[model samples]
Target: MNLARGSSDDSGSLLWGLGAIALYALISYGLDYRARARRGSRHPAREALHDLKDREEPQSPRHRIVSRVIMIGGGVLTGLVAYTTSGTLRAVAAGLTAVVAVTAWAYYDHRTETRDSAG
Candidate 1:
């Protein structure tokens, strides 16, 4: 008996799943943003262990806005690709690719800021 069945029209489920993942990611990001903002980026672990405030500061508004835009755009791209392709795997792959691209962009931006600060 072989049970490797797959549907070509699983776009509905794929879109739903992608939306759920994006929603989860957005919530996580928002919570992290708020927590870090409130805590002021100081290493809580070190503060607990050595009683020191974090010298590093919270990210700026521009950074937060850009990150949020990436997440939203990724979600939209995932949905659109899924709708157009009508294939579960392809849609998922597209969504993942979008997320990776957004993350890489953010990382590059962050590295540039770090380099600018150092130099």
Candidate 2:
């Protein structure tokens, strides 16, 4: 049995899956915007732009720990999904990539916080 050739038959299924993801993202964004509006954020775009700036205050150690835990949990969930949908190799790659990415993010955040506090 040619696995590659057999997988080609499910090309349409892949497209449908991608389309569903896109639709879900759109709805999520819409709901977030609605919530922001309800909160009296008259200038959502401006608020978003402002949010891109460095935070004036550093996150507490407790918050950082919680964030890291949540991020790792998300990575594990992603790995499980990849394993079930794809294969062992892909799952390992995805899980490792997620861990590396999250580590890099944490490092960067820490560096930024240190720099901001020092200067």
Candidate number of the best TM-score: 1
State residue 82's C-alpha deviation in candidate 2, in Å.
14
Could you give candidate 1's per-residue lDDT for residues 1-119 as a string of tens digits? 43332444453756565664565455435444554557686653443323112134434556545655665666566555544454566556656656665566457546655755675
For every model shown, the clashing-pair count is 1, 0
RMSD of each: 10.0, 9.9
The true-versus-predicted C-alpha distance at residue 51 of model 2, in Å, is 7.0
lDDT of 2 at 109: 53
Model 2 Cα displacement at 114 (Å)? 28
Please give, for residues 1-119, the per-residue lDDT of candidate 2 as tens digits. 56743444444445443443343334334443454577799876455344324232465565456645554454544444343354355445545555554555456555655765776
On lDDT, the leading prediction is 1
Q: Lowest summed-lDDT stretch of 10 residues in model 2?
A: 48-57
Name the lDDT of candidate 1: 0.53
Error of 2 at 113 (Å): 22
Instruction: Report clash pairs, candidate 2.
Output: none
* Poorest stretch of ten by lDDT in candidate 1: 47-56
TM-score (all chains, Cα) for each model? 0.43, 0.36
